[model samples]
Target: MTPEEILPDDLMERIRGRAAGYDQDNSFFHEDLAELAAAGYLKVFVPVPDGGLGLGLEAAAALQRRLATAAPATALAVNMHLVWTGVAHVLAARGDDSLGFVLKEAGQGEVFAFGISEAGNDSMLFDSGTTATPEGDGSYSFTGRKIFTSLSLGWTRLGIFGKDAAARNGDGELVFGFIGRETPGHETLTDWNTLGMRASQSNTTLLQGAVVPPERIFRKLPVGPNQDPLVFAIFACFETLLAAVYTGIGERAFTLALEAAKHRTSAKYGGRSYAQDPDIRWKIAEAAMAMDGIQPQLASVARDVDALVDHGPQWFPKLVGLKVRATENARAVVDIAVRVSGGSSYFRGSELERLYRDVLAGIFHPSNEESAHSTVANAWLGPLEM
Candidate 1:
């Protein structure tokens, strides 16, 4: 079946309904992903000949949003596969055939680790002294530890970003090769401790000069301070997906706050109802408004990103602008959740408290603040030939 037929309509609704219960019970999410693999949802972006949906970023963004709203941790788990599947799909459809097998494997229930981070200094986006250089015998050895890798349990492949440091920096080039998580020299060190995205199962990956055959490597693509259209689309999708999940988390938090407010009574004014006070009422309205405010911007950004890919890559800077807004809105969603939940929301397992911790994950990504600064500076200084 085509990607359009990959998931039944009932399954989508089922995943949505599954979200409400995931926090309370994780059975469905932990297994549903494997189920998604069985059904080929994981490889939808890959084309038919390669055994995938051949879907574009627009559809991928929607799927990302849907899974994210269902279970934040589950969404985090799938992000690894989506990224691998995406680049691999492009490679396959564009005529590189080897990567197609990995996509097929992914569709058949195999998973890859996003082993980008490292232990000493944070390096998820950039390679932190990791190197993939050639051995005299026609193979390259991957060395160095990667920290905070997600869905580390039972993974089969890894999308690692490393540089052939022997070359100059920037031109040093970053490569994300697909490697077996259990490759002989590879080691996994557990120590997942996080305040949010709890149960994400993040851990450290140590490749002790693990040797990867040249055949295991997908050709490295060019990336820079200013990325190409495909890279920008991935970044846009990442930001948009994060925004939607935070919105979902906030929605749950707001509901908790509203329910608490409705039943809460205060004796400060001699048995006055807390929910009856104008100040308290304003918080509820504000939280609802913030939640409502995010939807249009989300839809707009998704549409613009979709339109750009089909036309040309010239307009990525515009999509980045929308992504920046979504990133800021994500932070706002958390603030609204906190405001409406009030003090008592701190109780453990409180959806507000959980979501508050969850939202923090959004900002942990590359500094959008820095990205914005450079963009504005470049635009003001005016553009020219690269």
Candidate 2:
């Protein structure tokens, strides 16, 4: 299906019109979420039989990029739901139906949100600050805090993880599971006020004895990193989808610059349009070149993941590399766009201003510049001597 089918231009414009208001009010994309759900966007990754589009990762990435071009905050918030469904699809395709329920629920109008990120938990998936205490009745109670929880206001199910301190002979076990929003012992804190992506409303979440039934507890693995299908699925969906969002941001910024170049005039250059100015043209060209270089890489990685083409140990490197490239290059494009658009972009009401702030958030996501660089270096030179 085309992006136009997934996200109609009329709906996109509606969402775009509300973006500034949502950002200014520091509110969630309630209207956008409702529209997206009604349109079955949350089920993009579910199988066709499950009443979804059944698109592969490549197509989903493309659709997300398009969505972000109109309303980045809405697109980023929806990405969490897509990530969970995408993970289920990936597992099912690999002959593991462990997360198939995710697809079924998504198709049934359930919203899934990611609850993995925690404060000071740089270990990402390998370790967790939360504790999952097992009950004799095959249920586990989680006690900890999660940060940067997107869709905090609307998610029906939240995918969370914690460390089982007593498991694996005290070697520590990482337990992953899903919990309902109505479940006792969890609180969604209304403290999402931030510099950018305000419509996402990603809030701090606290879990105190939140229980997960045995069937819902998905993966159990060692405390540290290892070869696991679950890990691969998470990285594949998370990184690629995230890159697509920022790619959309960059794409929009580039288009804005091109339009400004064509229409904006320079008093110093014989009343000629900025498009005729060699320096302004150079800036646009530079931004276009940088954005052009990363598009193929992003497309290739997403398609390769869908094709199940194994890159072995290099997979993490490639995924993180694509994320870093897309995000950093997006920042560069936005910067150039701002420069080309002149001082008007510096004002708070400018679309370029909002995009500038949104693009900055890319560097703060997982596989950040620091972690990405380390991963690539380790991939090439092996672990450090120390």
Model 1, span 1-386: residue lDDT tens: 43235556666566545543554543326656666777777776666665667675556655665555445666666776676666555545445565666767776667776777665543334444678776866567788888767777747888676667555554765555667756778887666666667556667888888877767766454334434333543455555555555555555566667777777777775676668867778887887787677766666666655454353443444444545554566566556656655677777666666666766776665435556555555665765458
Ten contiguous residues with the weakest lDDT in model 1: 221-230
Q: What lDDT does each candidate get?
A: 0.62, 0.93
Model 2 over residues 49-162: C-alpha lDDT tens digits? 989999989999999999999889999999999999999999898999999999999999999999999999899999999999999887899999999999999899999999
- TM-score, cand. 2 vs. native: 0.99
Candidate 1 ranges with C-alpha deviation above 4 Å: 1-29, 35-40, 48-54, 89-99, 118-128, 136-138, 167-173, 221-230, 261-277, 308-324, 379-386
Model 1 TM-score (2 dp): 0.76
RMSDs, each prediction? 5.0, 0.7
